[model samples]
Structure formats: structure tokens, C-alpha cells
Target: IELNAFVAYQREREAISDSAPARQLFNWCREAGLNARGLEHALLLRDRIGAVCRRLGLPWVEAEPAGNPEPVLRALTRGFFGQVSIFSSGLRG
Candidate 1:
């Protein structure tokens, strides 16, 4: 569980909030029995992801201006946040 958490946290910190790495981290947390209610850590992880993406010029579909945005990043963020919300809620319950 510790290893998983560490990996997840690291991935989240290094990638975009909705990137594959961030999603993987959240998945790890869920599989490791970390409660969604304890998702302050996860939220921090997401924040890190968002920062990294911003630095890397990744476009956030929901937040970015309309244009020829990075489709991969947009999709990833949508899926990532959606999964996070769903799994996080499951943990809460």
C-alpha cells in the first residue's frame, strides 16, 4: 500500500491532473484501500498533475480556451477527473 501510494503520488506530481500517470496513481490509491474520504492526498495529487500539465503546455479541455487543443490531454483530463470523482465517492461510502 505504501509503495502504491508513493507511486501514485509521484505520478500525479509529475503528470497532468487528467493524464495517464495521475489516473494510475488514483487507481493505485483505490486498489490499496485508501478511502475517498481521505482524498486530501488525492486532491493534492491532482493539483500537482494540473501544475505539471500547465508547465508542459498540455491543454485542459474544460479549462482551456476553445481552439485546436491537445486532444490527448483534453480526453485524459476528462477521464481522469471523472474516474477520480467516481472512485473517490466510492471510498467515501
Candidate 2:
């Protein structure tokens, strides 16, 4: 659920094309027992539904005690989009 929400966020914000994760998410939803139409509709309501996850914080679990949080996040972002840029100019996402 959280993964879908995150995908919704990235697509809606234009941070990435929906083609990247959005198609994967649709297939995932069908496998997870959700009706594809309903899931798509819900994802379309990203601002009200999906954004809640971002507002409340991402759906995440720490798997390692020794890992740094920032690197893990950077890794995920890069894995998802293939490239990432961190502004040394103090830009906030």
C-alpha cells in the first residue's frame, strides 16, 4: 500500500514518469487482490489519498541497525529513477 502511495507521489509530482513505477504498481495491485479499476481510481486521487502517506511519513521499515538513513533513501531514489541529484545549493524537495 505504501509502495503504491509512493509511486503515486512520484508520478503526480512529475518527479518521474508514470511509465516507470506506475505500470508496475498496477500489476502489483491486481496481484494483491485489489480491483485494477478501483486501484487506479484511488491512485488518481493522489493529492487526497496518496499524499497522506507523505504527510504522515513514508511507509518504511528499518532493516539494518548500522545503516545510515540518508544513504538508504538515496539508494532507493536512484534505484527507482536511475539517477538522482542533490543540490548543494540548499534546495528542498
Best by TM-score: 1
Those runs of model 2 whose alpha carbons end farther than 4 Å from true positions after fitting are: 1-19, 45-93
Off by over 4 Å in 1: 1-37, 63-93
Looking at model 2, residue 69 earns an lDDT score of 59
Count of clashing pairs, candidate 2: 0
lDDT of 2 by residue, 26-92 (tens): 5655566556566556557755754777788976454355434565577667876643343533456
TM-score, one value per model: 0.28, 0.25
| Predicted candidate 1 versus true structure: per-residue lDDT over 1-93, tens digit per residue | 233454454555466455475466557657767653466565686689899999999974453443334754676799999999999999988
Find the 10 residues in a row with the least total lDDT in model 2: 82-91
| RMSD to the hidden true structure, all candidates | 15.2, 16.2
